[model samples]
Target chain A: MIDTQSSSGSKLVWVFFLLLFFAHQDFWLWSDDSLVLGFLPMGLAYHALFSVACSCLWAFACFRSWPEKLEQWADEAVDPDDNRSAS
Target chain B: MSDFTFLASAGEPVSRTPLYVLLVYMGLLLALGVLSSRFFRGTSKDYFVASQSIGSFMLLMSVFGTTMTGFALVGSSGKAFSQGIGTYGLMASWSGLIHSAVFFAIGIKLWSFGKKYGYVTQIQFFRDRFDSKQLGYLLFPILVLLIIPYLLVGLISVMKVVQPITSGMFPDTFALPDKVLPNGKSIPHPLSGGVPGWLSGLVVSTVVLFYVFFGGVRSAVWANTFQTVVFMITGIVAFYMIADKLGGVASAADVVKNHAPEKLIREGSIGDWHFFSYLLIPLSVGMFPHLFQHWLTAKNAKSFRLTVIAHPICIAIVWVPCILIGIWAAGLYAAGDLRIPPLPGGGPNANAALATMVRTLVENPLLSGLLMSGILAAIMSSLDSQFVCLGTMFTNDVVVAAMGKDKYSDRQLIFLSRAFIVGIVLVSYFMALYLQGSSVFSLGVWCFSGFAALFPLVFAAVYWKRASLGGAVGCILATLFSWCYFFYQDIFLDAGAGHGEYLVQGVMPVTFVFLASSAGMILGSLLTEPPSRETLKKFFPTLS
Candidate 1:
């Protein structure tokens, strides 16, 4: 985990997230007929790569920026009598 | 092959392979349901939410599976055939980003609250959070209304795709006619005695209902996991086999280029406005009732991490193949090597295009049946979840909320939920029959658009401390009115073009409706008294 509590780390994560969002709009490649490998269309191939890149960004965020505080609070505050009706 | 007549009686089969593959797949799902019930804790909560015992991988597969409906596979392929490659860009790519993003943000938060509050349905959560029974009543009808179109498409896709798979299984019952395309190519014909479209649909709905009746979301999760793996693997296998049948991927590309070159370009097919507006459509998943139920089943917050990370990749694996195969179908048809069932104005019935391609190109009936089952798996996976969710909402939100949860025994609750599900299955079955001949891709956009428009209500209820009771109600009303107006104009009033071609100046109505929804949320909340601090503290505990 990359010290997500740090201000710099949070900022860098946001930058990465925004970049991935914008990069999804690949207008320049819309009409490009060039195939990525031997067959995939340029626009289609670019999107495939962009989707993979988003997976990595999410992986990073999940690992580094996991919301530990929310879990701790919920765990602490959950009353034993709070509708525990199992069968 | 395309025209369906109700089979009068069962008959001997020319090829039993396809029907056997379908039976085996359905049996496996039923078996999974039976097996999952052994682990059921025998509580309504356990049935509905799986006792929040589901781990990260199960949660990931189940959520991804529930989200990947026939809309993603059959409908996307259909649109890709009718429209072009932009279909992938418009939905699959954008959904990969937006759906997972919503999971990471909204899903985890809702799961936390649900785990804390003992909530079973989205309506239950909001009913408490907003402290309004009236809001719950209002939401119940609208949510069900949105879900109807979504369910209709699944029924439509299953019925549409089933005819081709069992084409020659019954060669003696009904008279078969050869359909010929305008290009002089003979379309595939259905042999006389195959399973009718009605029986095929009944089998699907019955299997789903049986599994759901047994283990509820636990079965849905298990079946979704099995279904997800089956579809993705078979989807890729079908992809390669079809590409090879077309003489490799490059040869396939050349065919499209020679015939429908515009399909390869987004500017040529789907414009920027429509493409970008689809971002709003995936937001609808944030509010999907089945997905909300799936989120509550997560064992912990950590369960969501896998779902958030892996969802996009899973989407790409399934959609890229389906979209490409559709483009290839257009190519093959134009090259005079293949024929698809025709539309009214002489276009391919795009919704059935994916299955048609699989059956036509991949020659082995066993392989063809397995691939068809894989697509069926993809479609059926969501069918159970959606059906179970409607049951959950009706039971937890309408019945239990109105007649206190304490009034009913756990057995009675389970019985009631199952009864409601059976009724919904029957009603939806009849409604689907009534609404046949509509386009799956077009209807899917409108349905997703409605939920996408109303979804933010739950978001505000979860995240915003100031989102008032009135705001919740206002948001629901505005989204309902706006969605109705847009759907009417697009579907009934203006019969201009297909789904993506025309929608509020190249933009989908979801955009304007979403803006209307947001405006309702903002103005409605500001105009009303703020929420009680007790409610705020309960939901947003870290309110420093």
Candidate 2:
């Protein structure tokens, strides 16, 4: 279980930054002349779709890679039942 | 209604209308300040960080609003006019992802640390985490220096938009001197009889100062939320009206396809290296002191979830229209379909491209005034947060912490903060006046690069246990040195070249600066002692 969890976590981190890397790369240099929907330029349309992909990917990160310890710390700090305050 | 017919149908110059709309917006911000001040609990903590009481929605809105400055609206559009559709790829799309990722990685972590340590300012974090008080001294000035240019970008853009919108309102009172054009025909200045840039900048500065001086961060948050809604709604409306005026979206795209097809494609002139390096600029958000202050205001780590998820969507809402408008302007100018406004010296002005397009395309005075106010909303949303953050930094980091926290009372701290805010506002306002005609996009990129170069320090400080005080200090000095060298080369030596130019071997200056700062940190830490074990445990308590 530990092995699977750690592997998945590392994989998620790699995938996140990899997506960012590809998003930043200007692959549209080749398809510069193409238009999407007969109105939007190919490059502009790619980025527009890329932005939605980013939103989805980040939402996944929030769900998967969110630090468990930090959540516990926040709960402990803000929760009235907890004996220790934040500071 | 044909395009040229609207020029003939131009009604009485509604120069005063934009100003009145802007005044009403300013009045709303002031009222919010006064109202939020009633909830002030008479504590410096409440005044500076709002007692860490900001919830998810307000936190998300304020962060989004603070990031979506006039740069996102006016700067993006202006740059798109010159650069093409790649403008979205250059900043906005990447920023949506990078900024949210930073908020998740850095912002939430900082919020957790701030709450655990009772820290208010970013300097406080560095000073404690690194176990070096001197680090604060080095950081306070550099952060403030970098931020001032960002502040100037906001001020300059406000003046740029307002000047054009309010032109011709005071023709009798303020007639501009006529100058001979390149074609040997004399034409009056476009903004000759309107509110001058200096006056517009001062008015904006004064309005921002009033609220930040009164309610501090709380008021800035409330005002940002209100402004965010105003700009987002009006931005969409402006985009629709402009598209309709240009004979619909399909027709507008057809115009570009026929006249300026190069704009639709990523021009070969923009090298791959320059395009890729534009990605590094968004990393600057990780180190923005204003963003740091906002991060510290989150009620808990969970509050950041909304910001991380919703922020990209908010960025898209604000950016797409601006980018499209700018690209559309290029096509319209090329086809001679629109009467493109000339600059003061009588050439096509890219800086005022968006305002010119809007004013020319939209015939309704009421709609134009609303659109102008929406642009102002975007500008002022950023100015308030920056104003309050500087004041908070000075009071918490410089005055109280340096002088000893016990040396001043809560009331005295608030008083000092307000005084410093007014002083900085005055300095920025004057600087804006002197630096008139600077491109908002270029100025904004320079400022962001400076901050992005310093990202190594914060990233290491938070994540690496071995990151030492010397390392933090070293990174800062390295960043400042490279920042100055590149800024000098780009501004003075290059004769005001655009971002497409390379610093060395087709690489951006940010590439070198980021590397140097990272190298400085790693080398400085290794050469010196590692951070004490106790210090590491404090920041990384979960680790054994």
Q: Relative to the true structure, how large is the alpha-carbon lDDT of every model?
A: 0.81, 0.81
Which TM-score does chain B of candidate 1 obtain?
A: 0.94
* Candidate 1: residue pairs that collide: B1-B190, B170-B193, B170-B194
Retained true contacts (fraction), each candidate: 0.47, 0.48
All candidates: interface RMSD: 4.9, 5.4
What C-alpha lDDT, on a 0 to 100 scale, does residue B97 get in candidate 1? Answer: 81
Which ranges in model 1 have alpha carbons more than 4 Å from their true place?
Answer: A1-8, A79-87, B1-14, B177-194, B498-500
The sequence of per-residue lDDT tens digits that candidate 1 reaches over residues B40-85 is 8899989899998999898988988888888888888888877777
As a whole number from 0 to 100, the lDDT of residue B187 in candidate 1 is 44
Candidate 1 lDDT score relative to the true structure = 0.81
Give me the displacement of residue B96 in model 1, in angstroms.
1.3
In model 2, what lDDT does residue B79 have? 81
TM-score of model 1 vs. true structure: 0.93
Task: Give the TM-score of each candidate.
Answer: 0.93, 0.94
Worst-scoring 10-residue span by lDDT in model 1 chain B:
B1-10
